[model samples]
Target: MDTQPNIRSYVIDLADQLGIRYQATPEDALADIATRLAGDEVVIDEIEDLLVALKRTGAINGNEMVTLLGQYLDEKFSER
Candidate 1:
């Protein structure tokens, strides 16, 4: 039995059905944000807020947004 989650297929199909074209993955998005945050201290809340703003403004699609948010939260909690 395959234990790994089969997550991406349904999302891809849903996006295709909805006619949504995604431009970047979560890692690409974090890289962009990391570039933007260069020369500054890393503040988890601030980064989260920035990502939330981007999502609110429709800058990133839902799947990538959640992925980015999950990565951010994982990093934030793991550091402690």
Candidate 2:
């Protein structure tokens, strides 16, 4: 069975636990979280490393990586 949706849900839940307010789109919420967590110099590599660590620790699943990280990247790039 396809588990992408489930992974995405889990990732969203994880985001909430991380204090990300879902007051807008997922991408917007991610951007807000990034700003609050990393400030202005939001390094892409550091974000990737953090996500990887989260997955390794089972805080997030492998499948949700693309869903969560990709949305953040999309939001960041759109501003460029």
| Residue pairs in candidate 2 whose N, alpha carbon or C atoms collide under 3 angstroms | none
lDDT of 1 at 24: 54
Worst 10 residues of 2 by lDDT: 19-28
Top candidate, metric lDDT? 2
Clash count for candidate 1 is 0
Candidate 1 structure quality by residue, lDDT tens digits, 16-75: 555555345687578768877786555445455555545655766678779967866765
Write down the lDDT of every candidate, Cα atoms only: 0.58, 0.60
Question: Which candidate leads in TM-score?
Answer: 2
Q: Pairing residues by index, what is the TM-score of model 1?
A: 0.42
